[model samples]
Target: METILNVEGMTCGHCKAAVESAAKEVSGVTDAAVNLELGNVIVTHDDALNIGEVKQSIEDQGYDVK
Candidate 1:
């Protein structure tokens, strides 16, 4: 499955890396990519992955996930 989340407060490469790292750490996630220019996070995972957990992971990195 794939999930696209709009994240706020990402303004640089570091923010992109942080968000990607957090998202990748979630169980069942296969890959994660962040587009700072678009404020979007694309997550590829299995059905077992919890969307709420993914959002929380990004939030833990100090960003707002919508």
Candidate 2:
């Protein structure tokens, strides 16, 4: 399964890396990709993953998830 989240306050490479790293830390997440230009984070994971948890992970990194 794949989930796309809109993340705010990501302005550069560091922001992208932080969001990606946080997303990947979520259990069951296989991969995470952040598009800085679009402020979107795409997460690839299994069905067992909860979308809310994924959002929280990103939020924990100080990024707003929408």
Candidate 3:
């Protein structure tokens, strides 16, 4: 499964990487990608991906989800 989160507060490569890494930390996450300009992150995971956990993981990195 996959989800696209509208992230806010990402302005550079480091910020983008932080959110991506955080999302990947979720147990079921297989991959996490961020688009700085669009302020979004694409999360790819197994069928049982925990969307709430993934969002919280990204938020813990200091980014907001839309």
Candidate 4:
């Protein structure tokens, strides 16, 4: 499964890394890519991946997901 998350407040390399790390914490996530320029995160994961949880994780990192 693939999903794209809309993240806000990303301003640097560290912000990108933070989003990537949060997304990776989801058990079913196989891979994740973030585009700071696009303010989007593309994730590849198994069907078991709970997008809400993933989003929450990213939000916990101080970013907003829409």
Candidate 5:
């Protein structure tokens, strides 16, 4: 499964790395890609992935997921 999350406060490579790392750390997540210019995250995961958890994980990294 793939999900696109609109995220805010990403301004550089570090922000992209942090969001990707955080999303990948979530259980069931296969991969994560961030587009800093678009302020969005594209996540690939199994169907079992809890999207809410993914959002929270990103939030925990000091980002805002919408």
Candidate 6:
């Protein structure tokens, strides 16, 4: 499954990397890509992945997931 999360406060390369890293660390996530320009994170994962977990992971990185 794929999940797209609308995020806020990502303004540069560091933000992009941080969000991607956080998302990828979640169990069952296969890949995570962030589009700073679009303020979104596209996450690819299996059914076992919890959407709330990914959101909280990004939130822990200091970004707000909408």
The Cα local distance difference test for each model comes to 0.94, 0.92, 0.90, 0.92, 0.95, 0.94
Give the worst 10-residue stretch by lDDT in candidate 5. Answer: 30-39
RMSD of candidate 5 to the true fold?
A: 0.5
RMSD of 1: 0.6
TM-score for candidate 4, residues paired by index? 0.95
Of 2 and 6, the candidate ranking higher by TM-score: 6
- In model 4, state the lDDT of residue 3: 97
Candidate 3 error regions (>4 Å): none
RMSD (Cα, Å) of model 3: 0.7
Writing each residue's lDDT as its tens digit, candidate 1 over 1-66 gives 899999999999999999999999999999999988889999999998889999999999999998
Worst 10 residues of 6 by lDDT: 47-56
Q: What is the lDDT, from 0 to 100, of the residue 34 in candidate 2? A: 96
Off by over 4 Å in 6: none
TM-scores of the models, in the order given: 0.96, 0.96, 0.94, 0.95, 0.97, 0.96
Candidate 2 structure quality by residue, lDDT tens digits, 1-66: 998999999999999999999998889999999999898999999998998998998898899998
* Candidate 4 lDDT by residue in tens digits, 1-66: 899998999989999898999999988898889999999999899997779999999999999999
Separately for all candidates shown, the number of backbone clashes (residues 3 or more apart, or on different chains) is 0, 0, 0, 0, 0, 0
Candidate 1 whole-model C-alpha lDDT, 0 to 1: 0.94
> What is the lDDT, from 0 to 100, of the residue 8 in candidate 5?
95
lDDT digits (tens) for residues 1-66 of candidate 5: 899999999999999999999999999999999998888999999997889999999999999999
lDDT of 6 by residue, 1-66 (tens): 898999999999999999999999999999999998899999999998889999999999899999
Pairs that clash in candidate 6: none
